[model samples]
Target: MFLKLLSYPRSLIGVIIFIFLTAASAGSLVIVNILFNNRKIEDHIVEFWTRNSCRLFGVNVVVKGLENRPEGGFLYVFNHTSFFDIFAMNGWLGSFRFGAKIELFKIPVFGAGMRRAGILPIARSRREEVFKVYQAAEARIKAGERFALAPEGTRQEVESLGPFKSGPFVFAINAKAPIVPVIVKGAAAILPKGHYIPNWGVWKRTITLEVLPAVDTTPYTIDQRPLLQEKVRQIMAPYFHGDDF
Candidate 1:
C-alpha cells in the first residue's frame, strides 16, 4: 500500500534528482580528468560517481564470490545487462579501467574525460581500429592495472543474454592476465535498457554481483582463446538464469 504512493511522484522525482546530481558531479570530474590526466583522480571520481549514483537512484547491491578474485592485475569480464551494471561493478571491485565504445569518447567533455581516466575507446565499426584498443588494454594490464570489460559488448534487455565476444579473451591471453568472470543480476529491474529514467517503485532493488573464479591464461596461447572463452561461458551459464554457479 505504501509502495503504490511512492511509485507516482517519487519515481519521477528520483529520476530527476539522479540526472541532475550525476551530470553536475560527473561533469566536474570530466573536466578535472581532462585537465589533470591523473589516473588516481579518475579512479576515485569513477568510484564515487558509480556508487553514489546507485544510492541516489535507490538501487541496492549484493556482492558474492570475492574469494575467487586474485590480488593482482586481471581482466574482469562480465555479462552486460544495463548501465547500472557499471555502477554495481565499480562500486564493488575497487579501482579498475574499462574498454568503452568510441561513441562515448566523442561526447564533448565526457568522452575526453573517459580517455584521461584510462578507459579504452573501442571502435567496433572499424576492424583495424580494434587492435588499437587491444594494444592499449594490454599495456594497462602489463602495468598492473585491472580492467573491466563486457564480452557481450553491449547491454541487453531484461531476461535476455547476448552472445559473448572473444576478442577480450585473446587480449587477456596476450597480456598473460587472469580472466575474471562476473555475473550481474537484477540491474534491468532497476534501470532497463533504452529507458532514459530509472524506476524507484520499490524505493530499492538489489543488484547482485557474482564474481566467479579467475581463468588463468598462463597455459593458454592466443590461438586457444575460443576454448578459454567457452569454458568461462559454461561456468557463467547457470548464474545467468538465477541458478547457482
Candidate 2:
C-alpha cells in the first residue's frame, strides 16, 4: 500500500473540491426540500449528489445481484466498515430510506435535508427515542416502504462479519418483513476507518455492492431474532470482509 506516497497530493485536491461540492449540494437539497418537499424528487437530488461525489472522488461502484431485490416492504441490512458505505449505497444501491446515527441528522443544511427526505434517525442511547423511531419505521414498512439498516451499528474492521446488535433483527421480526443482505467492499481501502478524505491514489478506486437474496422473517418471532441475524450473516460472510472481497 503506497499510503502516504500516493495519497497526500491526490487527497489534497480531492478533499478541497469535495468541500465546495458538499456545501453546494447541501444547500440545494435544503432548498428543494422546503420548496417541493416531495420524497421522490428529493431522492433524485440525493442520487445526483451521491453518484457525482463518487465519480469525482474516483470511487467507481459496481453493483451486483440487483435482481435479488424484492418488490418492496423489506428491511435491508448491511455490514459497516467505512462511512462510504452510506455514500456508496446512496449512489448505487437503489433508492430506499436508511437509518443513520442521530449525529449525522444534526449537521446544518445536510441534516435538514435528510430529516425532510424521510431518513430515520436512530437515537441509539435513548431508549424512548429508539422506540419512537422504530414505531415510525413500522408504519412506513406497513405502507410498503423499503428501509436499509446496518445491524453492526458502527464501523468495524472484520475478516468476515462484524458483531451485530439485536435491535435491527428485533425490528425485522416485529415488522414481519423480509431481510435483504447487502455486502459492500473496497470503501475501507479508499477512505480508511477514521479519515474524511478519500484517497484516489494514482488510479480510480472501485467499490462493489452485492445485494444478496432475501430472507423471510415470517417464522421468527422476537424471541428468535438472534437466529434470524445469524442466518443472514452466514449468507453474507462468504462474499465480503476478507481478502477476496
Candidate 3:
C-alpha cells in the first residue's frame, strides 16, 4: 500500500502542509519563549507542537509501558528510525532535552529555540565537544532533569540498524542515571530517512512507543561500558524485530 500510494503530487502537498504547520507552531513557541522565558512552558509548547505535527502527517502514536519509566533522573535511549522519531519521542517523553548534532544548532530560529529549550548539541566529529556534551548531560541528570539520545547516532531504516554508540552509556554511568530503552515502531513508514516529504498514508502511519524498564547504571563501572551497552542493545533487539505492526 505504501509503495502504491507514493504519489509525487500528494507527497509534495503533504510536505508543504507539514512545513507550514511547523513554521506556524514554532513561531508561536518563539513568541511564548520570548514572553515567558520559562523552560517548563517552552517544553510544553514543544510537546504540543510535536503532537499536532503528528496529526498533520496522519501519524497516530500508540504508547505502551509508559509506567516503566522511572521517577528519578534517567536517560532515555531509542533506536533511530526516521526524522519523525523526535516528534514521537518528545510528544510522549517527559520534558527532557535531547543530544542533537551541533549542526542543527546552527540553524536560525530552530537552533535558538532548541537552546532556549535546553537541548544539548554534541559535535560528533570533535572529541572535546563530545566530552562537553556528556558532562552537560551528567550535570542535568544530577540536577534531577532527564535527557534522551539515539545511540545509533543517526536515522536508520527499519531493520537496518547500526551498532549503538558508547557515549550515552558512559554518560549514564557518570551521571548514575537509569537508562530507559524505548523501541519505536512504524515511524519509518510515515517518513523515511533522507526524505523531506511524508507518506501521510493511514495504512502506514501508526507509530508505537514501547518503553522498556530502566537499566540501572549504578552497578556498572566505567570500565564496563561496553558490557552495559551490549546489554541494553540485547534488551531492545527483540522488541525491534518481533513487532509486526
Per-model CA lDDT versus the true structure: 0.79, 0.79, 0.81
Which residue pairs collide, candidate 3? none
TM-scores of the candidates are 0.90, 0.89, 0.89
Query: For model 1, where is the 10-residue window of minimal lDDT?
Result: 236-245
Residue runs of model 1 more than 4 Å from their true location after superposition: 30-38, 242-245
Give the per-residue lDDT of model 2 (tens digit) for 193-239: 77777764544788889888899999998878889888887887777
Query: What is the overall TM-score of model 1 with all chains considered together?
Result: 0.90
User: Weakest 10 consecutive residues, lDDT, candidate 3?
Assistant: 2-11
Model 2 segments more than 4 A misplaced: 1-7, 200-202, 240-245
lDDT computed for candidate 1: 0.79
Candidate 2 scores a C-alpha RMSD against the true structure in Å of: 3.0
**Candidate 1: clashing residue pairs, number:** 0
Residue-wise lDDT of candidate 3 within 1-245, one digit each (tens)?
Answer: 65446555565676777677666666666787789887777787888878877776667888999999999789999988887889989998768878888998887777777776778888888867887779966777998888889998878866445688888999999999999998888888778886677764443368888999999999999999999999898888776555322
lDDT of 1 by residue, 71-172 (tens): 778989987878888888988877888788899887766666576677878887775787778876787788888998888778887645577787788889
RMSD of each: 2.5, 3.0, 3.3
